[model samples]
Target: MTPTQRHRVLALTPYARLLSVWQTLGIHTDHRCVRGPDTGMAMVRGRMGGSGNAFNLGEMTVTRASVVLEDGSLGHGWVAGRNKPQAELIALIDACARQQAWARRIDSELVEPLAEALEEERQQASQAAAATRVDFFTMVRGE
Candidate 1:
């Protein structure tokens, strides 16, 4: 089947746990937020006595994430800004929830690469922190 067909099924799979694995390994994305133009506005009149004007100026912020599989299938998820991880996790899950042959390819290729990258980052961070190790001492007053 086509990559698109496979992606559709993978998109429905339960892959939220993958995101946690990624986070544990330190491979993560920055927060992404989207705000649409306001659709409602208030009218204001000139203090000197002029006609009032009305405009649209209402807006809300929406957070989302996108993941592309090895076979080129893309998945996206929208969530609240406070739940950025959830959004990314959902996106990845959807990308793997498909039943197409391409889904297996994507899991092996794309997901594997991502997991490796995350693990590498975690190791680097650990090494860096270790390099800054310090020891402290306290005096004995009873002596």
Candidate 2:
């Protein structure tokens, strides 16, 4: 899968859902940490109006982890928060996705469902907001 698609899967998926999907796939993952479930600050860079010179916005807390599967596939997961378990799980899923044997199943079962759920959640939020929306127009007064 393309990097963008993979990024979406990792970013939007909740920790519980990932665990559930792993169980549903019926494939056990026994992984050893190749790097870390380490948390650190990553410098954030930004540009003004999307065209200005890049400037350091600030440091954001990011957690990253790497895992090596028993079958020799490598995966790394990074997320924008301090949740180590989430990062580790994402890394494992990514490692599985990298292996050709597991790629299709990962995309079909894990990524697709997570994407759908994210979309549905967004839709619900939008509808709820819409329900509260008010439109005002001037009305003519008859004397």
Candidate 3:
């Protein structure tokens, strides 16, 4: 897969699902973290009304990690929470997924299932939101 595809897969997956998948695989890996899973606030910038001037929205908590697998593949993981263990696991998975031996299994077993689950969750949320939407219209008055 292309680097963009790999990134998209990782970004879309929830940390909980990632953990579950890793546990299910039961793969023994020896790796070390090159960077911390430290939590910090990241400044969020946004444009007003979707196309207006950019401004700082606020800061959000984020955790990032970097891990190098035994095969020397370096993987980086960043998530939107202060979950250090989750970040570490994600980094490990990222490294493992890049290996030729583990690539196929990781993609098929972890990425695919997680992607499907995420999509289903999004669909359900969209449906629920749509059900609550209200449309207002002007009623014509006969004179």
Candidate 4:
């Protein structure tokens, strides 16, 4: 997958799940964090009806980290929340994803499962919403 898609999956995958997958893969690589797993607030904005004037949604907690692998590949992770370890691990994984030696394994082992799980969750939510949908019909009045 492209880097954008890879990063999106990394951001969405839960810390626990990602950690489990990492352990299961049994990967050990040397890396150093160059930036923080620092927590801060980011302003969220939204558009009314998806196209109307934009308005502030509010601020959300964000944690970001950056890492460089031994092979000199760099990665950055930005996730919503205050989970520092999760942010660091995401950065490491992102670095691995950029490396030629690790890219295939990272994609197949880590990213694919996470993406599938995300898609499954999306499908379930859609089904739930569909169940609550209402249909309306009106009859024309006689002239």
Best by lDDT: 4
Q: List the residue pairs that clash in candidate 4.
A: none
Lowest-sum lDDT 10-residue window in model 1: 33-42
- What do the candidate models score in CA lDDT, each in turn? 0.50, 0.85, 0.83, 0.90
Instruction: Indicate the residue-level lDDT of 83 in model 4.
Output: 97
Q: Put down candidate 4 lDDT per residue, 1-143, tens digits, no spaces.
A: 87779989988988999899988988898999989979999999999998999999999999999998877788998999999998899889888888788889999998999999999999999999999999889989997
lDDT-better candidate, 1 vs 2? 2
Clashing pairs in 1: 9-97, 9-98, 10-96, 10-97, 10-98, 11-94, 13-97, 38-58
Q: Rank the candidates by lDDT, best first.
A: 4, 2, 3, 1
- Candidate 2 residue 94 Cα shift, in angstroms, is 0.7
Reference-based lDDT, residue 127, model 1: 94
- My TM-score estimates for the predictions, one after another, are 0.35, 0.86, 0.85, 0.89
- Which ten residues in a row are the worst by lDDT in model 4? 93-102
- Give the per-residue lDDT of model 1 (tens digit) for 1-143: 34444333333333454444444544333322232211222233343333456444443444466777656656665543335555556565555545364356555654555556666777999999998998679878985
What residue runs in model 4 are displaced by over 4 Å at the alpha carbon? 136-143
By the TM-score metric, which is better: model 1 or model 2?
2
Q: How far is candidate 3 from the true structure (C-alpha RMSD, Å)?
A: 2.4
